[model samples]
Target chain A: MTAWKEIDQHVKVWMNYARKLILAQIKTDVQVSTKSGPNDLVTNVDKEIEEYYVKQIKLFFPNSLILGEEGHKDSGMLKHQGYFWVIDPIDGTMNFVKEQENFASMIAIYYNGKPLLGYIYDVMKDKLFWGGPACQAVYCNNEKLNSPANLSLKDGLFGASCPMVLRNYRGINEVISKSSGARIVGSAGIEFINVMSGKLCAYLSFLRPWDYLPGKILAETLGLIVKTIDGEPVNVLSSTDVLVATDNAQSEIFKIINNY
Target chain B: MTAWKEIDQHVKVWMNYARKLILAQIKTDVQVSTKSGPNDLVTNVDKEIEEYYVKQIKLFFPNSLILGEEGHKDSGMLKHQGYFWVIDPIDGTMNFVKEQENFASMIAIYYNGKPLLGYIYDVMKDKLFWGGPACQAVYCNNEKLNSPANLSLKDGLFGASCPMVLRNYRGINEVISKSSGARIVGSAGIEFINVMSGKLCAYLSFLRPWDYLPGKILAETLGLIVKTIDGEPVNVLSSTDVLVATDNAQSEIFKIINNY
Candidate 1:
């Protein structure tokens, strides 16, 4: 068995370093570029942060396979026999470029295809929600977080993607209308933190691997459900329509999605 | 004209006191009640804060007229001959009860039927966005804020009430689709802050006097437009469909709303 405590300490140190670098760039001119379209944005800072994590992981765990959002996918490196790491360098790149707030840095670790550890760092707020299967508990900064209540669709607020709601994709409008309200924070990691902290009951969006990986691990550790909208297991290797919610909310949401 | 600097100092002191009272109640259980529906919430803290402000206002400016969200409307007091204070003790009460963040305490002061000063206190973050016609500039905490860019509707994000979007009220869905995206922060004060800070280009909602008064004062001072959706003036004494936005965004949004 790995020394999980020692690994946690090391990861926290690197994450704090990453936080410093992120804070230093806020309000300064950042070179932003389009990814798929004008709405999809990526920045030089995102690439720099991803490269920093890849270098740190290789230095500390030399044999680890790495997957990053900023084009670091090397299928040949995936032996699937040892440790693996997924990094999102900067989640909510649009919010990062626009508001300079509400974005996060995320990392998830796996061992032999099993989830091991995850971290979602809200760099602007100086909060790191981290934990994993090995620890069996999630911590926000220093406080161990309690699992949110298993609220039904009517009992709590919902978060969803704007495009999905505007288009009423897969009946998301029906799902959101039943809740207290809908919130669109524009950051999947921040939305996940809302679910984990009980601020939101569920977050539904079509997300890429690096966008949902760390949030999924951290959320699942707190007794929440993280799965595809179709009630299928998340592939972890491909993009999917994702739903992260408390148990009761997931059951309620599943009924709506299935009916559609 | 009215010892504006001295009054500003006094208001800041009272606002800080109110902030302390609010922070103390967070994370602790408080009685919650419905105002119009389950989605429209009011808490004991809301009532307490409103009463606290009323008491302070009476003690300091004994002759001032007060209009508050939690039933402090006395039409007889509104002769438009002296000082009038409008207050929304907790602008986003649902958020305050559910998330304990994103809510704001708002106050607007009018002298002889003209707006004199306004304050929007983001209680949790300790950010007070305050200014007035007398001051000629708004301030976030201590620094004077710059006016946000006059971006067109297609250039920035938009915020709106959930029901409005779900029902496509006034063609908001079409307007939102034309923007970069939609964001729903659930607080008019926070949404106004976003527009003033250039994070969101526009915010649309049906708002009461206390809900939009302070934000309107600050936003107008920053050169943003605050008007009824029908191109009429917003009455300071009643509820109306209000739209607050940058100049360019307002022109674009007006076309859509008028067409609908």
Candidate 2:
């Protein structure tokens, strides 16, 4: 196998192992605590999963840079000219604690600032959607996903952030009105999966690097659009409002956002 | 077995059969069309499922009055003193056509204006959550579900209607802000499942009789509150805004709506 193929194999194995750990933790009393606020929660499982990923990365590729949600941040690592991995130990921590479903674990790897492999695992469902530009096709497990039809905003469901929808931020209300309906799964990764699987036309939310990177990589590779509400490239380092959408939907949304 | 038990067994078998029919239709070319507007979608599969349910109900209970989402509407059936069946063969028709995952099939049986049983089957997930006050316990598949802890609005996720959240109607914005966060699944049956399964503390939406009745029956059996935004009892014969919530969350949400 080629170098990328080998890396893919190793990462897949690590993800499955991590899934086991996360599932095991749920069976026990999960140690939960507040972070920035009461709603912003972090559990012992999140930390353990992140630490597990960091340890594996260090052992396999010592020179690699890691940016993880639960710590393990190498500032300015996006500029690093080597293996760089972005990990969200558990996306939608609230959903994990509350629903125990609709949450995901994601990892995005970049080689010398270029997209490599991207993986987002719906841990409970045991469905791993992973691929990148290198593979030339995204796969939900072994079946490669076809590029979704370029559905317009009016033709598909639009995923929105609850706060954005509530506040009508950036003409989101107008955008939602144009779509068939709005859905909020409260997990960026799962929402991204919805779009990637041709289930949703677009997904918009304020997201961090680790939250958006894996989905962004997989989405863009499938001929989807990932950018800011203003139609600008998203900075990999900053937390900002991001929109990942189908081509036709992106154009339709831009019309609404620009009017706002 | 008791009369209710026999009915439950037969209903479970019918639901599994309907699930098979629906899944089979998805594998073929689904016939889709609009109702009311382009956003309000219905499919041949939806009609077929409803027809199947009606046939089963009529065969088993010949005197039953059926109120179904597709076509079978026995007017003023809620006042009927015999078996009254409410069938939403496919709830979340939009989701069924667009996502094929989040939608559900629901059947609510009432006898002499009293709820006897409710069944909501998440078709794709193959999970059947069915029960009533008659059963004294709701069961997801074979496992009995406990009544969720009465979480306050600040302690759990709240499910909201897109339009309500968008317009901030009825002070939904204030109610959502008080909750840990907001979620919109676009399927009343599924949202009710979330609440029934202790995943969401509350779910609010504007729904017709078929849209809300099954969930209402099931949710009330679990000691959850189901009422209008004004804290009034929900009528079984009309379309209105409904709220199904945990006891504590119901009180908290009523305070927000009252203040509004």
Candidate 3:
């Protein structure tokens, strides 16, 4: 098998193992803690899942570097050659803690600074959306996903960040008013799935590296556009307002944002 | 069996049958149509599901009056001193047509102008949230659901209508800013499930009787508050801005709306 195919198999196995760890503890009492502020929650499951990924990556591929959501970081991984992985084990910690649904676990792999493989596991739904430029197509489990319809903003539901919509940040409210409607599922991974699946035309939010990268790789592979709100390329390591959308919606949203 | 118990059983069986009809047709080409506007969608599956429920209700309880989302209405049934049923063959028509997920089928039963039973089946998830004052407890399938904690405005997530949040209707933006965050799922039945399950502290939307009745019945039965934004009694036969929330969140939201 090709190296990419072998790595893909390993990542899927690790993700499913991480999924079990999360589901096993979800029904029991979750040890909840706050990060940054009261509303920014992180549970014990998130930490354990991330730790498990970090350990597995190290065990399976000793040369690979890692960046993880729960404080696992390799300071100079980006500069190194070979495998570099980004892990968001239990994205949407708030949803995981409160609803135990609508959350996901994700991994994005880059080889020598090129996007290679991505995996996003909708933990509750048990749907794994994985693939990248290397694999040449994205999949929701065993089914390969066709590119979503090229819908404009007005033709599809828009997914907005709560803070952006609430504060009318950059005139997002104006943009929302022009769409069919808005949906805020509160999990970036789920929102990404919506855009990739043609359920939503676009999703815009302030997202950190781990929050946006896996979805970015998969979405772009499916012929969707992933970029900064300003229509510039997104910095893979920085937190910024990222927008993943159909080509038509990206142009429409850019028009609104530039007008704002 | 008691009359109410028998009715509940019948409704459950009928809802499951409706669910099957919906699932079977969901993957095939859905015959799409519209009502009121382009965004207001209805599919042949929706019509089929409602027709099935209406037929069953008429067959089993010949005296029961029916009001359905897809043009099945029995005028003056509110005045009848017997069972009155409201059916939304498929809630979240847009979601159903676009995402094929996050939508539901619902039924609300009233006796002598008083709410009796409510069932909201999340078709894609295969989970039915059903119960009423008659049952004395709410259930997700077979397990009984406990009342969600009475979280205050800042302690929980807030669910808002896209238009309401966009227009800042009655200062809903202010209320959203005070909560942990805002979520807009665009389906009243799904949002009601979130609030009833304590995933959200509140959900506010302008809904028709068929849109809100089933959820209002289930929510109120679970020790949650269901009322108009102004704290007035929700008229069961009219369209209005309804709020379903925990006690503390309701009071906090009412204060904000009143000030607005």
Candidate 4:
């Protein structure tokens, strides 16, 4: 078995270094460009940050497989029997370029296709929520995090993707209305963080691996359900509609989505 | 003139005191109740804070008219007003009771029907965005704030009340889709703050005087528009649909609403 505890310690150090670099770039002018469209943005910083994390991963775990949002694609490595890192350098690139807040950097690690460690860093707030099976505990900064209350849809707010809500995809509007309200912070990692913190009962979005991987690891560790909208396990190698919620919330959301 | 500068200075002191009281109550168990419906919330803190402000206003400006959300209804005072203070002790009371953040405490001073000064205190962040015509300046905390960029609807995010958007009132969904995205922070004061800070292009919602008063004063001072959807002035004593936005965004939003 891998020394997962030792790996967690090293990852924490790397993430701290990554945080410093991200903060340093916040004040400087960002070079922004669109990927899928104008609404879908990617920044030079995203590329640089992803490259930085990949470099760190490669240096520390030379044979590790890497899948990153900023165009690092080696899917074949996922099939290898070794450590694998899924990283989203800057999760909310649009927010990063526009609001300069609500964005996050996330990293998830797996060993031989089993979850190992996860880190979701709220860059602006300087909060690092990290943990996994190996660490045996979920934490925000140094404080251990409790499992979110199993709030029903009516008892808490929901986080949703704009396109999903605007289009009312799979009855998102109805699901949202059943909740206290909806929040759209435009960051998958931040949305996941909100779910884990009990600030949001659930977050549903069509997300890629890098977008949801770290959140999935951290959230599941805290006893929150992270799965596809169809109540299936999330396939961390493709884009899919994902739901991260407490037990009651997940069940309630699934019933709504299924009925629709 | 009403010695507006002196009044501003004193209001700041009262606001600081109010801030301290609000912060102190944040950690205590809150007594929550509903108004209008379950979605429209009120807390003991809201009542206490509004009463606190009213007491200060009555003590400091003995002849001032006071209209507050927490049942300090004295429309008669407006008629004989030397200074009218419109206050919403906790503008996003639901958010306050649920999230404990994003809500604001606001006070707007109008002298004989002319806007004089406004204060929107983001109690948690400790940011007091205040100023008006008499001051000839707007500020977030101590720093003088600049007018937001004249961003068009397509260039920035739009803030809308949930019901308005869910029902597509005034074609809000279309208007929001034209913007970068939609944000629903559930607090009119925070939405106005976002527009002034260039974080959101506009905020549209049905608001009473206490809800939109402070935001209107500060937004206008920053050269942003605060008016009704049909381009009429907002009536200070009644609930109406209010739009707060920069020049280009306001015009673009108007065009979309008018077309629909």
Q: Report the C-alpha lDDT of model 3 over B1-260, residue by residue, as the tens digit.
A: 13788998899899888888887888896998879987899999989889999999999998889999999999887798888999999999999988899899999999988899999999999999999989888999999999999999898999889888878898999998889889888899999999999999999999999889999999988999999999999989899999999999999999998998
lDDT of 2 by residue, A24-125 (tens): 888576888998888888899999889999999899888899999988888668678788999999999999999989999999999888888899999999
- Assess candidate 1 and give its lDDT: 0.89
Over A115-150, each residue of candidate 4 has an lDDT whose tens digit, in order, gives: 889999998888999998877789999999988788
Global fold similarity of model 2 (TM-score): 0.98
lDDT value, candidate 3, whole model: 0.91
User: Which residue pairs overlap in candidate 3's backbone?
Assistant: none
Stretches of model 1 off by over 4 angstroms after superposition: A76-79, B76-79
What's the CA error at residue A113 for candidate 3, in Å? 0.7
Displacement of residue A39 (Cα, Å) in model 2 is: 1.9
Least accurate stretch of 10 residues (summed lDDT) in model 3 chain B? B1-10
DockQ of 1: 0.82
lDDT agreement of model 4 with the native: 0.86
lDDT of 2 at A247: 93
Q: Candidate 1 chain B — worst ten consecutive residues by lDDT sum?
A: B73-82
Which is superior by DockQ, 3 or 4?
3
Q: What is the DockQ of each candidate?
A: 0.82, 0.86, 0.78, 0.66
Which 10 consecutive positions of candidate 2 chain A have the poorest summed lDDT?
A: A1-10
Candidate 3 off by > 4 Å: none
lDDT of 2 by residue, B62-139 (tens): 888999999888876867878899999999999888998889999999988899999999999999999997788899
Please report the candidate that would top TM-score against the real structure. Answer: 2
Model 2 alpha-carbon miss at residue A79, Å: 3.1
TM accuracy, model 1: 0.97
Per-residue alpha-carbon lDDT of model 3 for A154-207, expressed as tens digits?
889998898888788898888888888899888899999999999999999999
Q: List the residue pairs that clash in candidate 4.
A: none
lDDT at B58 for candidate 4? 91
